[model samples]
Target: MLDSGLYEQLHKALWVQKKLSETVARHWVTTEYQGLTLSSHFQPIFSISHRRPVGYEGLLRASTDSGALIPPPAVLVLPNNSKENLELDRACRQLHLQNFARQETGDCWLFLNLNSQCLVTEQPDAGFMNRLFETTGIHPSRLVIEILESEITDRSYLKQLIKHFRSLGCLIAIDDFGAGHSNFDRIWELEPDIVKIDRSLVQEAGKSSRVERILTGIVSLIHEAGSLVVLEGVETRREALVSIAANADMVQGFYFAKPQQLISSNHEEFVSVIDELLQHQQRQRFKNTHQINENFRKIERLFKRAINHFSVTQNFEESSEILFAEKRSVRCYLLDDAGYQMARNIYSPHYQQTMDVRFTPLLSGDNANWSHKHYHFRAVQHPGQMQLSRPYLSVADSRMCITVSQTVTSSDKQFVFCCDLDWQDN
Candidate 1:
């Protein structure tokens, strides 16, 4: 619901929009221009945590008098001048508002796309939205003004217009934020409440694991910037999983629902989709965890054996023989209490054969200081306990590996025994 005071202020502030009271009716509002009829269709934007639609993005649907449809991209150009642009933009909003008001909107928002040209226009009249809100009995707070900041060249004017919208108590969203020419500069300047990620990013994330990680990082950055993320164009189950993995706050696409003339009240269908995705994710996580534990159990046995042998014989290479027998074990080395390497790395026969000679300079870590590594500090922090580090690229072989470190004392001096196990398979 919109706030009454906000509507009062808006109605008093401006009158730029063309009057549409005659066109407005009980169930819908339509504007005719150049023999074409314009109406509004809504596509839902769902909240991942809420498992329900938090809003619907209002899209324009234009058709000829003969009932042939005109794509929305072509509809914007129907208005030639700034005045016509303002009129069409306002008419579209009025139509969306009236139709949306007739539904059980509850507290969900109505996302309206404001033309950039109309936003920057120096037209005299204002208060169109104000009068519309008053007429439709929909609160301004329920409105979300989506602006494609990249299209507006006059950023100062854009900022002022956004500020005005904010003053009217409408939420602001930066639409298609990950598309061409879009940058964080507008996000920093406008400080929008929501940033809708472009579908291209969603498509790329679904195609590549590296892109999936990047998408997660991008979502994290947006959250840090104090705005929620809406991953748009999630058209498949894989893309939906990517959205969840990226931690996007909301999702909108054909995977859940498509744009329609009427809003669907059946939220259980959307809930079921999200429920199944979560279940699949949970199963995958359990399987990964179980596999990691099983692998660790085998490696730990060999690691303990090596440590015991080294403690008795004080021979690094001889003791590491048992560990090297594992196909995944890359190398083992001893480090002093201060993290200085105590011996040259004892590599597995497999590593020696497949090792890249280009990294010959880094192959021998004897006398190298590993104090800066997380595995070293973690092992030092908890003496006598095994520390398992997350998989990372090993500086020694340039291959991905997980480090298992344990601190042990020999001859009254502490030493850290560390082994690198290849993580390419798991």
Candidate 2:
């Protein structure tokens, strides 16, 4: 360790410059703090389309002199004095940068976790990280500053800190989204370059199709907000497949690789993993497409017959009985060209038994305008061609269902014929 005089000199030189003493090893950098060893480990983040590692998130590892490990939570617990916490956070960041500088990562980013304490305590324009970047010879563009936006209560301070980082050419990422009290407001306000979805959401997706669809919507919304989505904590093949199906931009977790000090040179290992996942997704997509086509064929036959009968006799119930004969059919209805319901829904007997009385107010569809729905507008857009919508929660019965619709011109009046099918089983 350097003497006290040399320590100040190194601090002036913009080295780690904290309470910890740094020791540069051959392959990595290490620091000593209260008799524990601090080191950096990285978990790879791979782009789904690129089929290779796009970047790595730096994780701090704390161990005893004898190599006994310490849990990350215990290691990162805030000290009673906020000053010590800030120093530790900066020290860990510097350690990560130094180790990353030695790796052969080639144009990939180094994602560093930024503690809320550091953001609150430091001056935004202090140029501390800029000086550190100069000392380590790492460009600011190569760094991704990860912040848990929920932890910072002061939106102004958070924005100022992010602005300062962006001014330095560092990419900003909202970390742990969808965990607790996370909303799209910050995403709209901060407009981060990347958003890391919390692991719990992905885990729940593996067990529930509803959660999986919700995940896909979340990813779509994030994309609409102009940020890439990274699904973290993917530990199983099922979770990885879910990520792919959800259209996540990137993924990171134990399923791909665990955190380690050395970056691997063999990129093909991860490429093969991505290739296999893509193949599985393609196969599943083909199977689902085939099933949906068969369903549409059956529904098409019944729908045309129903349309013909209703057109001539003007009887909704008698015409829709054939459609209600399908086991999955829930209800059938008709809408005018402007999307106002022309009549009450004809509910299948089996579906009527399972209706939730709590949603009785929404049971009647007469005069309700469904112009905003995809089923209505899509049929209007395609004219005579049938439209099938993805499964969505139906307000009429408060159950998950898919809608099949087609526009029909009968007796010179245009109508949109729609049928809902129970999606709980299929």
Alpha carbon lDDT of each predicted model:
0.86, 0.88
TM-score of each: 0.81, 0.91
User: RMSD per prediction, one decimal?
Assistant: 9.0, 9.3
Which candidate's TM-score is highest?
2
Error of 1 at 297 (Å): 2.5
Q: Can you give the lDDT of residue 36 in candidate 2? A: 83
Residue 290 CA displacement from its true place in model 1, Å: 1.0
Candidate 2: stretches off by over 4 Å: 1-27
Per-residue lDDT tens digits for candidate 2, residues 1-426, read 899999888777554422112332455789987778999998999999998889999999999978899987888774556677788888898899989887778999999998877658656444678888988888999999999988889999889989988989999999999999999999999999999999999999998888999999999999999999999999999999999999999999999999987776567888988999999999999998998888778877888888778778778789889898787889999999899999899999989888888998999997799999999999999998878898889989778899989888878899998899899944
Ten contiguous residues with the weakest lDDT in model 2: 16-25
